[model samples]
Target: MDVTTIIGLFVGILSLVVGFLIEGGTLGSLLQETAAIIVFGGTIGAVIISFPLKTLKKVPFIIKYAFTASSSHSMTTVENMVELSNVSRRQGLLALETQQDMYEDDPFLSEGIRMIVDGVEGETIKDILNREIELYERRMLSIGKVFETAGGFAPTMGIIGTVMGLVHVLGSLDNPSALGPAIAVAFIATLYGVASANVIYLPIFNKIKARLDDDLMIKELQAEGLISIQYGENSTLLRNKLMAFIDDEVKSESEQVEDVNVNA
Candidate 1:
């Protein structure tokens, strides 16, 4: 589980509720089942209509991704690639086939190594893996777009709910005493919509985009690492080349300070 995501969520909710309590607001004043049903139901209906049912079905899995560790394997994968490069240099490329079990933790890296061991041409390997990368990117984007669509629809749905509530209030103008609370309840849907969009849906969409970018970089690095090994690039050079893809991640704080000083 991702502690950062959990902590961030807890912090966001706690801040809002604590501040609300400090302002003399009770939880009961904000708890409106009708407003929740209207905002969430309308938003979900709009999202389902916006996207295909098949893609919507994957929402739970994609949302879970936000609360989980990133799937980026660039760091470990570079090490593995360097080891494979050494093996190819000392023994031979074909010797990699015997070491398949060693890379069971990462199937994509293992598959790339298998291609190199099978003596696949550099161009052919690049073409196949590039296609794989493109397909993977499209799939991830589809999932991200689901949350994107929900975020887009949520605020609009909230406004619609408010309008519906106001229409009812206008129809019952005889109950002037109920008007104040009715107006407050009418805007709760808007609050729910805006809060859900900013706090949940949009955040998840952006998180998926960032994670997918990292994942694709790892895949691209694997493709290049495998191809370089197949072409018999020097092991040290190949390791350096792969590590370059993740420069920001590998840079130490001291190196970052030096960079800041240099830029200054």
Candidate 2:
């Protein structure tokens, strides 16, 4: 689980509630069942109309992905590539076929290696893997779009709810004493809409996109590694080449400081 995501959600809710309390707002004033029903129900109806049923089925997975921290495999991928390079250099490309089991968990890596062992051309390997990556990206992004769609529709739904509430308020104008409370209840729809959009839907969409980018980078790294292995690149040189895929922040801070000291 992602602790930061949990912490951020908690902080956002706590701040809102505490700030409201400080401003002399009651919790009861915020708890309007009618407003919630209108905003959320309308938003859901909009989302359902916007996306297909198949795509909507993945909401649970999308939410789980947003809350979960993705594991970094850059270093492991680099090391594995270097190992494969060494094996191919010593025993020829055909030897990699026997080692396919080692990468079974990663079909992308395994398939690339299999193609290499099958004597696929370097350009063809790159083309096939790149196309696969593109398709994977498109598919994942379409799923994340559910959140994006919801975020967009929520505010509009809130406004609609507020308008509907105001219409009712106008209808009951003779009850002057009830006007302020009616207006307050009507505006709760707007609050729910805006808050849910900002704090939940939109953030989850961005988080899913961030995770997707990470997964794509790993796939690209593996593809590069498999191609390098097929071409009989030196393990040391391949390792250095693959190291470029790792983020600078992920590299050791001590090593960078030591390099500066050595230069000094």
Among these predictions, the greatest TM-score belongs to 2
Mind giving the per-residue lDDT tens digits that candidate 1 earns over 132-227? Answer: 999999998998898888888889988988898999899999999999989888988898888889887888788888778888888898899889
Residues 149-261 of candidate 2: C-alpha lDDT, one tens digit per residue: 99999998999999999999999999999999999889989999998899878988988998899889889888888888877788888888888878887667536766999
Computed on alpha carbons, the lDDT of every model, listed in order, comes to: 0.85, 0.88
Worst 10 residues of 2 by lDDT: 249-258
Per-residue error at 66 for model 2, in Å? 1.7
Deviating ranges (above 4 Å) for candidate 1: 71-73, 253-264
| Whole-model alpha-carbon lDDT for candidate 2 | 0.88
